[model samples]
Target: MKARVTISLKNGVLDPQGKAIAHALHGLGFDNVGEVRQGKVIELDLGDIAAADAPAEVEKMCTQLLANTVIENYEFELLD
Candidate 1:
């Protein structure tokens, strides 16, 4: 099984990197883009431990080590 985790800043949070990218895009003549937010994606191969509780376990992992819940929000998808 494969798990994909995505971590992103909350809506009200400021994202400097994303803003920079947006500005660069606008400079390159890409219009109609309102805002951009940067985030991270982590892919994990949990070989053989693909159970119904996997999503919760992964969420726990994010809360415990992968993400700073105080500023970022995390979500995950499990694939077989």
Candidate 2:
């Protein structure tokens, strides 16, 4: 099975990198952009552990390694 994890900054958190990207886009004449938030997508392949409590394991992975829970939130999906 394949798991895709998305980690993003929570609301009210300041994202300087996202802001910089948005500003650069505006300077390139893409003025229609409203706002931008940066995040990460991590894909994992589980060999034998795919069938059992995968979501919880993935959440643990996010909490322990993939994300900084202080200012970030994560969601994951499993695919066959």
Candidate 3:
């Protein structure tokens, strides 16, 4: 099975990197862009894992190491 995890900052959190990217876009004549938020995607190859158990396992990985869980939120999906 394959899994994908997305990690992102929660609402009301300041994102400096996202801000910088927005500023650069505006400088390049893309002023139409609004406030930008940044996130990350992680792809995992969980070989031989059952479909029913993949979500829980991946979520555990997120809570333990993949996400800060303070200012960030994480979600995942499994693929066959």
Candidate 4:
């Protein structure tokens, strides 16, 4: 199975990178854009892991290494 994890800042957290992106977009004539937020995507290959256990396994990975649980939130999807 393969897993895709998405990590993003929680609400009310400062996102300087996202702010920079929004500023750049506005400078490039995308004035209509508003409130941009940025996140990261991680793809993992779990060889031979059963589908039933993938969620818990991936959640452990996220909490342990992939994300900073204090300031960020994560969600994942498993793919065959």
Candidate 5:
């Protein structure tokens, strides 16, 4: 099965990297873009894992190491 974990900053949290990206975009003439929030996608090829178990397993990995739960939130989805 294939899976994906998306990690993002919680609401009201300041994101300097996101700001930088927005700035760069505006400089490149993308002036209509609004606030840009940044996040990350982690793809996994969980070979041989059951479809029912992949989401939970990837979520555990997110809680343990992939994300900082204090200021970040994560969600996982099974792709196949």
Candidate 6:
């Protein structure tokens, strides 16, 4: 099974990268661009975990390392 972890800054948290990207977009003529929030996607290939348990296993990984739960929120999807 394959698992994908999507991690992003929690609401009300500052996002410097997102701010830079938004600024660049406006400079490049993307005037209509609004708030930009940046996030990361981590794709994992699980060999031992069963499909039904992939999400739980991946959640553990996120809590351990993939995401900084203090300032970020995470969600995961399992794929065959």
Error of 2 at 63 (Å): 1.4
Query: lDDT score, residue 23, model 3?
Result: 99
Task: Report RMSD (Å) for each prediction in the order shown.
Answer: 0.9, 1.1, 0.8, 0.6, 1.1, 1.0
Residue-wise C-alpha lDDT for candidate 6, range 1-80, written one tens digit per residue: 78888999999999999999999999999999999999999989898777777777788899999999899999988877
Candidate 6, residue 32: CA error in Å? 0.8
lDDT tens per residue, model 1, 1-80: 88999999988899999999999999999998879999999998878885887888898899999899888999999989
For residues 4-69, write the lDDT of model 2, one tens digit per residue. Answer: 999999999999999999999999999999789999999999767846788888888999999999
Give stretches of model 6 more than 4 Å off: none
Point to the candidate with the largest TM-score.
4
Better of 3 and 4 by TM-score: 4
lDDT of the structure predicted as candidate 1: 0.91
Please state the error at residue 76 of candidate 5 in Å.
Answer: 1.5
Estimate, for each residue in 1-80, the C-alpha lDDT of model 3 and write its tens digit. 99999999999999999999999999999989999999999999999988888888999999999999999999988878
Model 3, residue 63: distance off in Å is: 0.6
lDDT of every predicted structure (CA atoms):
0.91, 0.91, 0.94, 0.96, 0.90, 0.91
What local lDDT does model 1 show for residue 27? 94
**Residue 78, model 2: Cα distance from true site in angstroms:** 0.4
Task: Provide TM-scores for the models.
Answer: 0.93, 0.90, 0.94, 0.96, 0.90, 0.93
Q: Give candidate 1's root-mean-square deviation (CA, Å).
A: 0.9
- Tell me which of candidates 4 and 5 scores higher on TM-score: 4
Candidate 4 off by > 4 Å: none
